[model samples]
Target: MELHALLSYTFFLLFLFVIAGETVWANEEDRKVANGGFRPTKLFVFGDSYSDTGNNPKSLASSWKTPYGVTFPGKPAGRYSDGRILTDYVARFMGIKSPLPYQWKKYGENKLQYGINFACGGTGVFDTGNMQPNMSTQIGFLEGLIKQTVYTKRDLDSSLALVTVSGNDYGAYTASGGPEQGLPSFISRVVNQMGINLKRIHDMGVRKVVVTALQPVGCLPKQTIFSSYQQCNETDNSAATLHNQLLQQAVTTLNNSTKGSSFLVLDLFSSFNTVLKNKGDFTGSLKFDTPLKPCCVGKKGDANCGSLDENGKALYTVCNEPGSTFFWDSLHPSEAGWRAVYLTLRSSLNQIYN
Candidate 1:
């Protein structure tokens, strides 16, 4: 065989091996959960791109473009990242297939009976930069379902809701002449609104709700690219810490006020930090040496990611293996990176599952 053909075959074999190993790992995880005696029936998701599963209108999102879903499912399915996000993993942990995105309603109805995802990319509790639906609007979609009798009160009685408010609101705040000194107040407002949203969902009939604490926003590739993706900016992390603290307190207050501790908080910041600290062991199928580096990036400081000319000429270079890297782009994680975080969250979820 020619050198090129030989190299291609070798790479294919390696890819197959990595996929097989991940399958085994996932199976083991399932067995562990089963033995521990936990089973959850439904998962309802709401948030931004991180948990969005194609809810964004196709014309409005770059996630619908090529290379977004190159790693899994073979095409862009509207996920902000390369593959599954936290919603998919949480659905898996619940022992049910990932529920379809709310936008895919016409595609199937069986999954909708289980649950629906209401997340949209670039959305926040308050209107952010994007014209897409904000958290209130997203919940309005769910409320419409109830009003239309799509999801009956009984359906929601046994359901679980996963709410993610990643930092889009903060991003919007920073861009719109909002003072950095007032970020603490903004954080309070965000959490306060989040608590209201959670209560509304619970009151609407959902049994248990899980809200994710903000991840280490300052550590994302977008913020750390200047550091060559080697070190997290402590300043950013400190800000995130404040946000998480307020969120934790809000969650506790919500639970207490509800007279039942049905609310749960998933700590993404700590989990992401743990994976960053032990990067070697959590290598994805692609065996990336530096998981922090993005797999696809804009060229020459342009604002586009992996852009190409009209003739399809390449304008960006892809990393060696997307699976090996934790981040697929400046703002999101690779599937493997999400999987590692899911593993760490197994215990936290068990609290809700039980």
Candidate 2:
């Protein structure tokens, strides 16, 4: 690829690494049972790279390259972190192995019992520049599986759906010349579509569907790096705040109208805020000395976490201790960062059983 195009692609992937947050293993028995009566037997994931295991093709996605999954699985496994992500943690919390990625469906028949993941790294609710399937299309893929009997209504009834819509939509919007003054209206549109998507998943017979509220995009290393990794840009944060507020209202409406109110929001904005405020010092145990600084970065401009030079030499620098850094790249979080956020989210996640 030409340098310019490759650089754009890398930056695109970087900005889309939004649900970024895990690393520690909880005791298996601790997650053996849920707090509520409804226990999910399977997990169906949708949205972006945060939950994607290996959906995006290797040739184009950096997640399939070296240094991405170095902290876990011993190599790149299409997870955009040093190790596991929110999806894996959620599965662990439910006492189940992480579901196989949808890309592996034809090959891993026996693993279907866990569920399928349809998330792609550089995707969003709307078609972003990444060219991956949009949220509507991703959901359509699930619908196709149901039509093929890959998943039955009974399977969905016992399943939980995880929908992550971090910041790729906004990334796409801004990149496409969207005006800052018009951001609130665009955010409204995104949240409105998200509500519709949630209802669609529920209509497909999934008893519970959990969607993520927008995280504080301003706090990601992508934005903070411009400030010398010292502070966040409140303008981006205000946009995320608006998105979360609108999403909360939308979810409430969906719940009030649906039977059993199967819709839930993960409150990523609050979770991220808490973790960043504490600098990964969750419960006074976990700590990321440089919470806003990424663990891996390009050696120079336009390079990325996994960038390689023309001679195939690595052009990125990885931290000596990835576990101490919150972000793994310009946008995504390290496993330790995610683990800290998950600790705070565990109580909220337990509500899925209710």
- Cα RMSDs, all models: 9.4, 10.1
Off by over 4 Å in 2: 1-36, 107-109
The superposed Cα distance between candidate 1 and the true structure at residue 4, in angstroms, equals 54
Please list all clashing residue pairs in model 2, or write none if there are none.
Answer: 21-338, 22-335, 22-338, 22-339
Residue pairs clashing in model 1 are none
**TM-score to native of every candidate shown:** 0.87, 0.90
In model 1, the runs with Cα more than 4 Å from the true position are: 1-28, 31-39, 107-109, 280-288, 310-312
lDDT of 1 at 26: 37
C-alpha lDDT score of every prediction, in listed order: 0.76, 0.83
lDDT (Cα) of model 2: 0.83
Which has the greatest TM-score?
A: 2
TM-score of 2: 0.90
- Candidate 1 has its poorest 10 consecutive residues by lDDT at 1-10
Q: What tens-digit string does per-residue lDDT give for candidate 2 at 1-354? A: 001111111111111111223233455222534333677988999999888889999999999999989988779999999888999888877666788788876634566888888999999988998888988999998999899888888999999999999899899899899998998999899899999999999999999999988889999888998988999999889888888889889988999998775988888888888888888746877787778899999988899999999999999999999988888999888888888878877767766767
lDDT of 1: 0.76
